[model samples]
Target: MTSPDDSLQLTATELRMATFRLARRLRCARAADSMSDAQLAVLADLRMNGRRTISTLAERERVTAPSMTNTINGLEEQGYVTRAVDEDDRRRVQVEITDAGAELVVETIRRRDVLLADMLADLDFTEDELTTLREASVLMRRVTDR
Candidate 1:
């Protein structure tokens, strides 16, 4: 005897929680030398998009300029990223991921993929069930992107 609005609210809550748990599980499957999540996030972005300015990264990561700088500093200390003056504009500084950073990201991804693959395999889901899960993942991504 629940109203439609209440049912929708419950569904939304469930979806949010499910996604959060899954993300947390993946995050936990990192390498022993994995950097902080913030640092990793910045490195991952740089890896994907080449070099980026501090302001660009700050905006993209929804963080303050100082916060991004601190994150960048930590990454620099670990040799995961390097900052250099922009050749096109000496006034600007650009950050780029080093080879070590790229390797760490790849290794972390492999670990997470292995963890997920093993767990999913253990579940022994039927083909239809796996297909449904894949479709649901796509739908959830669409929901997020919107």
Candidate 2:
């Protein structure tokens, strides 16, 4: 009794809901691993992008300058990051992640991977299903990249 258009729309809606639920669950599981999400995000950014100014980091993180300052201060107190005056411009402070910070980023990524692997294992999905998921991930990344 249902038209093909209705069937297609229902399938699309289900896929969208499933993807949203999976992402939400994964984020929650990752958060439970250790560091707060903001701390982890900052560390990961520094590890990947090297040194940056407080203002730059604030812009990238979509936080206010004062909030970014506080975050950086906390990180420095924890010995995860260091701030030094730029040699060419003494007034400018550049923030860099220390070796310890990089280690934390690596550990965080490993924990997330473990969590995801466990979830994938429990799914009992076929190889085709995984390939489809992989393709969907690529599409999702492309959409975000814009």
Candidate 3:
């Protein structure tokens, strides 16, 4: 009884809700107990995008420079990150992840993967459905990358 457009809208809404639920569930499996979500996000950003200035990180995270600075200060105190003067520009400081930060990211990812894999194993999805889910994940990444 629905138009094709209406069906697409319904599918999109359902997908969004499902993805949110899955993400929240995975958040509980995080390994970095001492890190706040914002701190962890900044660490993950550095790990993925390489070293960046505090201003750049602030813009990426949509927080004020001072707010980002405070977050960075806490992270530094925890020994998860360090700041160094940019070799090419003395005026700018680049925030870099420490070895401990990288290890935290790896452990967090491993925990999430294990949790998700166990949940998937408990599900009764067919191989074809699992393949479709994998394809959907790829498509979702491409959508967000734009």
**Per-candidate TM-score against the hidden true structure:** 0.89, 0.80, 0.91
Each model's C-alpha lDDT? Answer: 0.89, 0.84, 0.92
Error of 1 at 2 (Å): 5.6
Residues 12-113 of candidate 2: C-alpha lDDT, one tens digit per residue:
798789878876766665422555677777888999999999999999999998999999988888888999999899999999999988988887677768
Question: lDDT of candidate 1?
Answer: 0.89
Q: In lDDT terms, how accurate is model 3?
A: 0.92
Q: Assess the local accuracy of residue 43 in candidate 1 as a C-alpha lDDT between 0 and 100.
A: 80
Runs of candidate 2 with Cα error greater than 4 angstroms are: 1-24, 27-34
For candidate 1, the TM-score is 0.89
In model 1, where do residues sit more than 4 Å from their true spots? Answer: 1-4
Model 1, span 1-146: residue lDDT tens: 99999999999999989888988988888764557787778888998999999999999889999999999998888888999999999999999999999998888889999999888999999999999999998998899766
